[model samples]
Target chain A: MSGALLADAPGVLAALAQGASAVLLGLGLLFWFAGSWPLLGRASYLTKLHYLGISDTLGSALMLLGLLLRFQREWPLLVLALLSLVVWNTIFGYVLAACSQPRRRP
Target chain B: MSRLIVIALRMLIWLLLSADPELLNVAIGLAVSLALPLPRRVRALSPGQFWRALGESVTALPQAYSQAARLLLHRRLEESVVHDEPARVGGRASSVLVFLDVFRITLTPFTIALGLEGGGRRYRVHELVFEEKER
Candidate 1:
């Protein structure tokens, strides 16, 4: 049974490979924390945004790409759909915010 | 029929990525099971509102698709700067939800989220570059 499961595994190994990068990212974050990176400790708002935004987006996207690659055969549509939904949600959120906001007179 | 198909496909994708098919089924069943009974508070004057909302969603599919495609074609615009004048406050929190909603907005390419505070109000915004209209 275990062997059969392994044989049917779509991107099981790829998932594991992606997991490795997750570990790398986690480690980098740890190093930054341990070194008390000035940005992490008390950086200005925009600076902090730069750090967290880059890390969060790249880390998440890399992890998703790995998973998608692994699961490509069995669930290609699902992967695309999930990615589309995430993108759409972000777009909708921006649109909603923009619509609700007022422009300044300058 | 199309609506059901869309819902089912969405459910399947969610289930697969979540890596838990049974949980997905259970959640869906639970949602359907619970949705039939309206709590007293939400028992609206007319049920037409629900159908109206559904119709709106059905009609919006084409627009959503176009928007999605347009967005995909471009590199994400991540940050924008907004210069906001001060805001005045009424009670301790009339604008609280509005403030929270604005700050919560984030984008893809270069949009910077600004948390606003002023005379009495709060806002969150991103600045975008658009050309001024002539005349």
Candidate 2:
């Protein structure tokens, strides 16, 4: 095969990976922006929960995924563990917040 | 000799956790030396007191270790919530627990920003509040 043919496969793969990373980055950015907007107004307790929960979990997950993709390592097991820990940490925050709050009567 | 052993062990643990081992060793050694417990005859303390202290510390150690590990590993709180009740205290942020020993207060990432030992005791903390109410 000619040199041009040899390079085409890798170039297309790189472009595809870049496109995927951009999408992931944009999604994470959107989550973060939406979650933080409530700080400007009189934010309620529920609002605060919404802000922290979505941003903390989904945004962080997306960000971590993007980072892993960028690294493009073959260590699948390590990556899975890292992602799980990040998600767990995010959920744990929500749990702590919930436990700290006083229960309301029906 | 026995007293010296106890002091030395305590110093070792402090050193392991501390950033400046030399400074902590000096400080702890000085404090222990200055505040050495009275002789067994002079103090006439009951043996039960020693056992009680040992038991309490033994129970507290695992908890302190887990809390410290969580801090080091960046483990987030499992549950945290904010509810506005009739303000028993004036400000939203009031009543900080310092040196409570409940959750390994010493080695936590949050350090006491300011403390006042007036009527009782008061502390101001500068911690990264993952969640806090604005008002």
Candidate 3:
């Protein structure tokens, strides 16, 4: 019994990791869908942009994190990608919000 | 002092990206880090402020997630303009606080800042659900 448990330990750990990765990926997809659905409604451009940008950023980050867990050897690249996503996404969202604002009259 | 820190951080990132600890890679990273122009005013958060922001974010995450989930599950979309009351914090600190608020709110799927209004003192935020009391 002890031998069997020892033999299955690695397999169990691997399966656990795989399951976690899949769950993360699924949650990411769900966020994407949730964020996108509101865009088809009567919300204004700014509202739509909000949902799309925030959800997309979170979803992408979650997906990258999932991949990072599944592929530990490529952590360097994955970490870089995740950092880029956070910084770039925020900057991009700021730019979009700024551009959408009304200009002040002289 | 901040410039040196920035350069060191860049070099570290360069090393990570290169994934090689060879002398040549290190030298290249050093050179690149030195070549990059540092910001004129590098803002460094105090440890206290950093901890506050971290704690605030930890507390806000669940609220944001539930808000998003509620919005999505109900398919309810509402638009209302809200302003952030003026904060007592001044100058760069206030700006940093505003940025932190924006970042925290946007991290959730429910709320997004449209723009800074009232000369950057107030943020015009669009929420997934509109609250009449705030309007």
TM-score of chain B in each prediction? 0.31, 0.28, 0.60
- Give the per-residue lDDT digits (tens) of candidate 1, residues B57-123: 4454444333323332342334435665333332243232232233223433233334444533644
Best by TM-score: 3
**Fraction of reference contacts reproduced per prediction?**
0.08, 0.00, 0.42
lDDT of 1 by residue, A1-106 (tens): 9998789686676666567756755644543342233344653344344334333433344445544544556565546654565445444445544555566442
CA deviation > 4 Å runs, candidate 3: A104-106, B1-5, B21-31, B42-45, B54-64, B85-88, B94-99, B116-122, B130-135
Model 1 error, position B125 (Å): 2.3
- Ordered by lDDT, highest first, the candidates read 3, 2, 1
Output DockQ, candidate 2.
0.03
Candidate 2 accuracy as TM-score = 0.37
**Residue by residue across A34-90, what tens digits does model 3's lDDT show?**
788778887777777767764777777778889987998998889988877865785
- Rank the candidate models, highest DockQ first: 3, 1, 2
Per-model TM-score on C-alpha atoms: 0.33, 0.37, 0.78
DockQ of 1: 0.08
Full-model lDDT for every candidate: 0.43, 0.44, 0.69
Q: Model 2, B41-133: lDDT tens per residue?
A: 232223454444345534653443333233334434333332222211222211222212212222222221222223223322223333221
What is the C-alpha lDDT profile of model 3 across B1-135, one tens digit per residue?
Answer: 446656876987897798888999899899989988867776655656655765775576566666666656654444546445443243355444566666666666556665556555556665555442132
